[model samples]
Target chain A: MSFLRTAPAFRAGLGMRTIHTSRVAAVQASKQVRAIAADETAGFKYTAENAILKGTVNDAVAVPTPNKAHGSYHWAFERLVSAAIIPATVAAAVASPTAHPIMDGVLGVTILIHSHIGFSACIDDYVDERKFGALGTACRWLLRVGTAGALVGIYEFNTNDIGLTELCEKVWKA
Target chain B: MARRFVQTNSISEMEGLKLLNTQRMNRPVSPHLDIYQPQVTWVLSGLHRITGVAVAGVFYVGALTYLLHPIYPAIDSAHLIEAVHNLPVWFKTSAKVAFALPLTFHSFNGIRHLMWDTGKGLTMKGVYASGYAVMAASVISTIYLAFFV
Candidate 1:
């Protein structure tokens, strides 16, 4: 009844005063953790750069806090480990961009072996094709087989730096 | 009379055939993984798989290192030496161990491949024997080089 009975001017004045007071209080609260500063929010939500831009005009800025479980020491240890691993990881990348040529040579030998096997397969197919008719399904299969083998042989011939003699030696040794 | 003679021969041959059963003739003689007790060979085989994986992993890391080395020139000799000096003793030791691992694997594996080439260690006995030697050599050389030098 007291609020309702107040004079119109008085009520209007009180209403204005209440609005001002509440706004001031809100402004003050916003200055602390009001999500006003993106940087502050970034500490909580995003990377350092992102948080800085995302905070609200009325928000108070706060940095991210680690989970309660980690405590102080765990964070410190994580940083220490990162410092150690990041460098060596970088160095090893430089020494050999690809497999060492020595390893490649081994692989090359493997290719040569496969090529020879392919060549034999081709010869088998050719012989089979000759024995059978050219149009028959079995003869067609033989032709395809021989062609694959020949192609492999040609590829091996192109890539192989090792001479036939060396190839023989290596294969025998294997 | 002729039928009787034939019958006698057929019966004798059947007896001879029973003596030469297929299972007896075709059965494998050598030890299989199932029959033999596990030994150094098994351990060595496990180690081979592990080392193979490690070698591949080492290569991957090595590749990444090489890629980054150019971008980050800070890893150059003077910087690296400085970094080494700055590192704790434990880290330095770890670096030494890491450095030796690939070298030791390559060396031991090379020798193994060489033995295989000579066709001397293809038998099971020879395989187990050489596997032990390779394992021992790899471990000893790795430790000696890592810790001492």
Candidate 2:
């Protein structure tokens, strides 16, 4: 306890009270995020509020420093991929898959990336690493592995068997 | 003095802060609208995700199984088509619908989402108009694809 002082609650959107925190306290202020006060659920720090913010009343909020990869650039890239899938889908539907082997592969890769992004969003929202910790980390890595396997599988299927369109048509007509 | 129903008590600053924080915790973490409700707007939005997950899940599973073909030598698309073809007509029809419904719905809703990305059809009236259009188109297309085509 070399120092003691009340700092402004700039990051604490929950309340405006000046939090009492030292430099050390500020560093340790990031409480486990919880949504419900029940402590079992993973979300904003609620029930654990007995220790305001972190361990002090005016501890700095633990908001992540902005990075472009997970910020606007991420949003733009997702939109671009989704938009590209539209034309790819329409073309794949129109063209003969066996004749345009490249088209089939393009569609397959787009679908894979799209599915990966979409499911990753679900995992981020529900089982966020910030809250679920190890479970979330494992789920993310598992998805990556699954995606990689599926990519290779798609390549193998396209090369060995009838491409995606022919398979769908044969199954539909079957 | 008039009969009083209210009571007042004084507490230390720390105690007051703790009380305030506890109350904040119990407070509902919502403002105007509830998080989830079964209305058309919410229901349709939820379906978009559900259908996307279902369709993509199937695709992923199907694609991933291709990797097993090398080991099993039987887990390939040729077997898959034959299996589907061998199923009873009713089962086939049901399976077709099951597969087609999500594909159509997700496709239509996905287009609607793309329209939104372009900053179009975002108003309340526009949203409902586009939503109803997507629903109608999906149902009709699914029926045609499943039964007729």
Candidate 3:
């Protein structure tokens, strides 16, 4: 084992019995150890920083900021509106004969918004703009037009006809 | 070390998509719906999307029918109501119950989803608890809406 350790020194023409050569070998070994430790610490920091910067750059280059923000807020708001509709609907259903126009109007708007968001999300998931560019655009426009017409129809029903909840109740008894 | 850096500026969106597609093609597809065990999370997620479409469809169809009421008097609200009213009692109850069930289930499960969005009820225990809670709420609400309301 010792001969193996000394082989490189002997090949480099450093005599093993010389005190100066041994001291020089010890100094080189310590320097190499220090260099390795320094490299490890530096490598760790570089890798961590590189990972973070790469992630940021990729997001900025690949995804539009508005699209990213669109998803979370849209999802949360849709859920919020749907949650609010529950109590309003139950109350509206129970108070059938006496129609509350305001409550009914609120229900109409919330349902429109909720359904529009849901439909839009489905379209976003299923339709790839890169693959079906024109179809995707058309579907989105169709949704907008359909939502507007539905909103108007709902408004008319709530006002001219018996409101939604009442109509459901009436249908139930029918 | 210098050779490790990749120049991404020359890469077009189409090229990137092609690369991704190639990689996807090479990998064995895993966790496919047909092969994977059906779990609560995915089941609920699928149901959420389905219910969303169903509810929107109901609204769209209703609105379209109303718009066409001029041509078809039978589709008018009064006539439609009367038509439903004339149905047998069992049919009426069953139809209303079926209609109410989806609406109530979607509404209750939706609230649970909203809770998840807020980062609550995400643990396994929380998920199961919320799932059972949503089921109970839907049943109770459906019964009330169909019968009492």
Candidate 4:
């Protein structure tokens, strides 16, 4: 207890010594400052209160305002379509060889949309304009073209041959 | 004992600014992946992304293969089915189950996400409940599709 009590006093003495020396050093340093040129101080004004430049330039001019509502709406619709396709897929699979054309068509469209949304989400994550400018643009265009081709291929398969679900069923049985 | 004091000069404004920027650069970032406890919400969300990519990949591959039917007769659905038929029993069953499981999980979890979008099932309890339900449904659906369907 006695040691603890004296420790702070010892620290205080050391601190006082350092402060006294720093004050003397500061006095000597101040004498070393070069005289300011007349032109350097010509337009300088001293004020008690600091002035902050306000509205000197617009910082948000290039920033794009995002549409939150559209984003959420699209997200919700993608989920809805995904959920809806489950039953459609199961029904088509079970009905197999004689599944109705309407069911096949619905499945094709829903699957295409779901895949497109999913692939776009991936592209958004890994291929952002902020990161990979020209490559991102190229990837976005490629996705668009791939989606179109997929839709056409699905349509052709459904119309000209046995539908997708039927083909899966055949594969499973095989 | 006399303490010897070594004097140092003040840093210039630009040098001070550079030092501050370097300090900022060296500071550790927060919310690192290792710091967070893995939870159902993010785990399921990640799985949803993975399954989404898997499903899309399969669809694209299938469509592309189908498009090449003229160039390669073996790429046709009948020929593909024949190839699968030649595989052993275990391989066939496992392949079907593997195919169906991800699709089932993704579909059910997607419904849960839609419910969240509608501002439902977002509480911790609700998230866990729905996550378990999706897993259960995926297992059941995969079984039925692989064995019965």
Candidate 5:
């Protein structure tokens, strides 16, 4: 009879040992889960703070200097190319009529005359720079163009019914 | 230690101007006219091209009139009359009107060119405004010649 009572106590002790072991494992797992969650939360908070700080610093530091510099350079470059290059090209085209080889003699002569005159004017400009100084440099090109223009005027006057031939004859004392 | 610095500066622009003026007291005073550079109309240039094309068109009209004149001599012989004629007053008047188109265009366009030669019509606003003026003048002249002979 004492042995039978000892058997029940021993079984109860075995059960208690199993339950304690399971409880210990469960506590360890819960602590590990808590640690993982804490770590994730800390990582998220750190990343968000870093992003906000970086964005604020970028706005404060780079906004004014970079923005205006980029804007003015872009606008000025665009305007310069449009205003200068395009008209210069058009003027060059006007001065050169050999682009149309099949033009009539009258038209061809007109074009050739203008183009040669233009080239001469360009040369005159270079010479003027050496001889006349900077003040005359500005007017030099104008003077050449004006001379060519005056010739064109004379041509028109000659062609018209204004008796320019008579006037010329008188001026020449012929 | 003691340091000494010389206090000498070059003359200012105003002082220089005063000195120059004092040196030239009896110089003749003439207002500078050419110093004021005039404005230019840029758009008139493009219009000048257009009017040149119009002048070519007028030439073609004259050519066509010459070609068609003999077929309809009663209608209008002015276009076909290569030589001078002793015609009725109305026919003479019509002939004058017909001849005036190309001449008038040439004259007006020449004036526009003269304006350009003087360095006028170089700006955007000036260009467009001058273009408008050219059109107005061309139209008025065309109408006057076409109707009034």
Candidate 6:
């Protein structure tokens, strides 16, 4: 058997002497998907962070592949959307529809995004793919489709109707 | 010779693991949410999310309902206003309170969250102070909006 030269994994060009042992069951790592254990799920294995209480020390850590979009950028985006809601809400409270028709549409979209992100966070926490399987996938897709439909609905309300700001104002008084 | 009163069973590695897993299935999860006494810190945190979901849920449902405008002509804003207007005075006031409470609480608590994001007001003392502050502010704001505004 050849030892890996200064690497955790065997490099592609490294030549290794073949070693066969009946004691150690051997299987190749999957090319398309990675699973921690032989019968484990592709994503995170632990149902909850607190599952460590019952877990073995040998359980593999679920290290996420960091992406710019889903990392710090997502946090920044969420904060930005939240901050944007402040002004949009103010405009909704005080602005006149006839004077600024687009303001209604702006508020609708901003609030929609903020709501979507909040719901998405809940779904991610509770309906994890590793735990909930098909149900989890369904919730995520439903959120997406619902968001799209809501966007269209908001657009229609803003364009054709008395607009959301005026509608809220009227409703509050009503 | 002392009498032995111990018994043991030899198990393969896989069998041992299976036994372990079976036992693990019945392991009680400690420090459950129900056992915790209600306090300002966690209570406010819970309320923040709950109120946020309540307010946002309404927003989403409203926006989604607008999609039905094409099919249901009576489902417009005018009809909604008329429907609410036709309700009794007590019902109207209570409805206003219902809407105002969650809206104000979520809004005020959200600012608290934003302050936290900027790495401010996160101390134990600061957290409590802010929690009380949010509660007061949200209550007053909701009352003002529901009763006066």
DockQ of each: 0.01, 0.30, 0.22, 0.18, 0.01, 0.29
What's the CA error at residue B55 for candidate 3, in Å?
2.1
Off by over 4 Å in 4: A1-63, A66-73, A90-99, B1-35
Residue-level lDDT of model 2, residues A54-141, one tens digit each, is: 3234444567899999999998998888888889877988998989988989999998999999999999877877667678899999
Rank order (by TM-score, best first): 6, 2, 4, 3, 1, 5
Give a tens-digit lDDT track for model 4, residues A32-126: 44333222212222221222111112212244567766577776676678787878877776664455867877887788888888888787887
The TM-score of predicted model 2 comes to 0.75
Candidate 1: stretches off by over 4 Å: A1-174, B1-38, B69-71, B75-77, B98-102
In CAPRI terms, model 1 is classed as incorrect
Q: Write the per-residue lDDT of candidate 5 for residues B40-139, one digit (tens) a residue.
A: 3433443444444454344333333333333655423222232233456567556555555544554465555556556887676766676567667766
Clashing pairs in model 4, backbone N/Cα/C closer than 3 A: none
| Lowest-sum lDDT 10-residue window in model 1 chain B | B14-23
Better of 4 and 6 by lDDT: 6
Task: Compose the digit string of candidate 3's lDDT tens values, residues A1-174.
Answer: 999997877866855444578788888887522212111221122221122111111234344557635777766666678788788776665654344777877777788888888898888877645335678789999999998888878877777677676776567666
B43-118 per-residue lDDT for model 1 (tens digits): 5555554554455344333323433444675533344345556777777667667756654664475457555755
Say which docking band candidate 3 falls in: incorrect
Worst 10 residues of 4 chain B by lDDT: B16-25
Taking candidate 5, what TM-score does its chain B reach relative to the real chain B? 0.37
Please write out the lDDT profile of model 6 over residues B23-113, one tens digit for every residue: 5556687776778999998988888889889988888798899898879999898899999889998888898889988888888888989
lDDT of each: 0.47, 0.81, 0.70, 0.73, 0.43, 0.80
State the TM-score, rounded to 2 decimals, of chain A in model 4. 0.60
**What is the Cα-based TM-score of model 3?**
0.67
Q: Encode model 1's per-residue lDDT on A1-174: one tens digit a residue.
A: 777677666968867544568778888887643222233322233221221223334334455586754655754543343233334333333334133333333343343333333333444544433333343446456445544443443334324333222332232222
- The TM-score of candidate 4 is 0.69
Q: Locate the minimum summed-lDDT window of 10 residues in model 5 chain A.
A: A48-57
Q: Write the per-residue lDDT of candidate 5 for residues A1-174, one digit (tens) a residue.
A: 899979868988778534568788888877522112111221122221122111111124223456654577754543343234234434433543233222222332343243333334444544444444564566666555544554444344334312222331232221
Q: Which candidate number would show the highest TM-score if scored against the true structure?
A: 6
Residue-wise C-alpha lDDT for candidate 3, range B32-121, written one tens digit per residue: 576778787778778778877887799887975676655765666788888887888878778778777877778788889778878998
